[model samples]
Target: MAELPLADYARTLTGDIQTLAEAEDGSIPRTFTRWALEQLEESGFVSNMTVAYHSGHGVMVYGFGYSDDRSVLDLYTTAFSLDPMVDRLTKADVTRHYRRLLAFLQKAGSIRGNFDQPTEVHQLCEGVEKLLSNASKVRLFLFSNCESAARTQPEPTEFQGLPVEHHLWDLARLYRHQTSGAASEPIVVQFDPPINCLSVQSVEPNLSVTLAVVPGRHLAELYEEHRTRLLELNVRAFLQARSTVNRGIRLTLLNEPGRFLTYNNGITATATAAEFVEDAEGRRVGIRSLTGLQIVNGGQTTATLHHVFKRDKKDLDGVSVQMKLTLMGSDDLMAIVPSISRYSNTQNKVTLVDLSANDKFHVEFERVSRTLWAPPTTPGGPQTRWFYERARGSYAVEEAKQQTSIVARRKFKAENPAAQRFAKSDLAKFVNAWSGLPHLVSRGAQKSFAAFQANVKEQPPVIDADYCRRTIAMGILFKEVDKVAKAHDAGSHKALITAYTTARLCEETGRRIDLDRIWREQQVSDAIVQAAHDLCPLIMDMVIQEGKHVTEWAKSSKCWEEVSRIPWTVPEELAEELLARPVEFAVDTREEEEEQLSRLKQIELSEWEMLADWARETRALELAEQQIATTIAAKLATNATITAAQVRKALEVYDNAIEEGFSAFAP
Candidate 1:
């Protein structure tokens, strides 16, 4: 939690990494790699394919798979020069790196190897071929922590006759993300000489709505430049949607070309700002730049355009499509952009929770937590503060304002439990850990998020005081276990420490201790803390023993994923092993929590009875019964058994009653 210079922080992080490397246990590097990849996955760089292993091809790490946008992803990560003066990455350096990797790609079919084979480069090559053959295009991403003075991009190349483009995720790019609290980089779209467009100011302040007819060539060119960055979070949904090629759109682009506008419903986009050049007569209509452009709608159309242009060598000179652009600068726009995207899509079925960064339920928790602080463990101890980041950039902004004292910033982070920094993905990881699904937990952030969203969709739990408190309590338990594990050091096996904390430590400790009661009391008991200190050492030993089966254990993402798969079942074999050993508690506390809740439910039922009776007895309720029943019936139809007649009756009288109440029943 200490606030050091940015360079110092990087040094410390990499220094710990160096120690992790020398320790040669594969825990630290594997753990750090997972954290960085998860951060990237959350930011929209990688998609469902997060698993990576060291290939020993002069590359530190490599992963090849399908990205969220349905593009072929061949990602390679390596450290860049930490020296501040090294401002630019040379083209020669990148070319040589790929050339070394090319040996594997050249013979993709010969890549059969065991899971932990040292020649994992062969598997990576096989992935590249699978993606290239099936995907519309292949993209290569190179990540580095070194700051680039300017945008240093890679030239496009070909693999097995498939189109491939290169993208650089350098340190300056990451620093910008750190300051802005953004996950993905903003894409700047320049429209030279003022294309055909119309602009109108929105009723909402600082928002402008514009409609423009963009040439197919220009659209294709933009996609070529930015690739999946333009798709935003919807990239996953876009890929998952029907793969039925838009044959009609493709044919039109290849054949008629001119009638493309009539056939296509143009894309709807959102941009942060618009730059315009005034005409000689000072007419402010010439647009020079469109910053932070994201294609919220019409993804399929744009992708189809690019695909046909490349595949069929179609002429796009006469092909143009309509585009609706929303320009807004308010931070609040981040919340609503997903809503706009959901409604604008005529093609795909979008899930509400998946569309936005975090839904209203998450934001409400942030709002509530900021108002209350958890009770300290000791009677007079300072209450542990809870900080919830509803927006990504707030933490950095808060730190910058406290520049005078590094201790003040460190105190802020210490007070704020790491678990309380719950974004949508973080919440998913927590819930999965508790749900007894170590496989889902091991699947990394995006997969965990999808699984969690699916769980919510199946049974929407009430996000009330108890739920929020318990969620925070779960976070407290996980973080506390982590602290205990780290303090023990476990021979610098931080990954094992992290893995055990989430997979076993939290689940076991949670089951044995009364978490709900602890949440209600607002503090962790020393009994649980001592239990973690006692249990972690044994768990670490088991993990280390399991890890010895593989060579280069700490070197690959696969090693961590493999370790994460170990069963964390309670009162089972592993639990029995631990219970047989000297430990603090050997009982499950959920039974006691359930007994208390059963009594509380009876009290709640009595309260509901009074409210139900009041509703039936009040004449005012009978007077508005038609409208109220209609509203209830409409909602009930979504998930409940309702007849067509009942639905029609509810709809038929509801509107007429409202109309009559306004005029016939007017006072």
Candidate 2:
């Protein structure tokens, strides 16, 4: 079924939202869940009544709701309520509901929202992070569109950029880890090692980054058409432009590909050069050149501004720019970054980038700011520095003012150490403001037992039973069982709960393998439930990577593992990492016999697979002649006339006999 159109959700629940949100704290009950959900109709949100599972808190029952056109903004979160040892909701409860709902939503899509919740308060933000991780599960669920004979679906991607090669790097790292004491090791490995991808870069003057799609990461079904559209409509145009150049003169341009090309960031094009010389008035402003390289459409000239991404193409022609760019290449070269240039894109988003100069691809820009005192540093150096400079130039006081937003800090780090420390150190004040909780925590827990013991020793004698009892409360003793399981059968990082789920989801849904059976057969079924554990960050990754094409999340950590591995190398045949092979020898005697029999049968079956019907008929004729001789000999009560000698003589006129081709055994 199609995903619930976000529009309808709003239309149905218009005024009723306050009832859902403002219900007397925890007043909503299971009975009301269904009624509220009926209002949702096609919305993918599940209700508390729909789920019955064990959660960190206790046995959890959940009900869900979502916004559609009713959302007014044309977007709203998929709402959910949890009945974990209770009924109804609160802010914290809703947040937890959102976390879980986000997990399920991510099972098929992408999600957007700040990790607004404090990380130190609890694992809520972390859970949200895990919930939002490599969210290909929802992506896979959306693969339903691919199964449709009606419309072609988009290809899967690491987010939506980072082509297969870029993905390959991540994949390489994943497979390296998976095969090297991570996931199940494979026997064969093929790779182009030590390769770095310049898939991500921040644009100059803006600090807006361009994230390239990982090659092969996007399944052909997810956004193949978009990519194809970019290629056929955008990439093709660039290629066509380059091909049109008379002799060494080359040119290609796009007024602006809107939205898609623009994406989460506004900048759209990148340029590079063999050498960029910031020449002009003594003032060293910025790279400036002639603006408005117009395009003639139906005899009407359309003004289009281009940014130079790479400059090494064709002698790195032109001058008057303050920055001298020479030998402009991909991100690997220090001369450039992977980012989009602004204003150049007014026509379209999701535009295909024009690539030129066999070895280099960059943005095309105009000369204007020839003096800024800053020389173009490679990759994102210029833009990052410029952003800081730009901020100080425009709003020094406001920029310097104390800010509490996490998103702000993430995007723009403060130059001053005091500003940097404000988030971590000042947080205690906010934490203490709460009445019940005592002391605060950092973003990370101790990685080792000694560290944990040290933390315990420092705590006051009066411990919060709530904290220590959480272990017995949840019944999830990860540390102890892990060691026991390791002693028995030690291969699994069983800790990476999400990847296992991803592997299973891929297997079960892809019809490639059965994961449940494997789980049951393994010694540690509890260990395998790591799916939801890793869910948070993976979903976050999906949203970060995708930006908007997909937004909304659900499912557990296990699902994200698949998304995380998108860039890594998994052999099509083996379906595991294609690097660092470590093999295990297994001898199943009965299985070996069965395999040998299958091989033999296959050889016999090849008789038909390899031969034409007439050759079979010719053999039949030879059999009939031998039978006829045998019949005549029986009538005469003597030796058969068609003896082996006679049959051999008749068949060997040319002396060369036809032999069956040998069949090779398939693994």
lDDT of 2 by residue, 244-346 (tens): 2121111322222222222222112222321112237432222222111111110001101111111112222221111111112333322222122112334
Worst window of 10 by summed lDDT in candidate 2: 294-303
Q: Summarize candidate 1's per-residue lDDT along 1-667 as a digit string, tens digits.
A: 3233466435434553455334334444454454455567666566544334445434344555464334555655454443533445566655555654454455445544534322334444555555556666666655555554444565677766767777666555555665565646677787766686667777988888887888899998777555556776453433332223478889888888889899888898888888876668754555678888888777778778877765566768989899898888747556668678778888756664343445555666676667667777677877665566655545555555556777975676567644345556666666666564544544445555666766664455556555666676766666566567666664324433544555565555444445565665665566666666666666565544531522123223454455445554443433432323221212233344454434433333333333334344543335455444544434444545544444444333444444433222223
| Model 2, CA-based lDDT | 0.24
- Model 2 TM-score? 0.17
The reply for model 2, stretches above 4 Å from the true place, is 1-524, 544-667
Question: What C-alpha root-mean-square deviation, in Å, does candidate 2 show against the real structure?
Answer: 29.3
What would the TM-scores of all predictions be? 0.63, 0.17
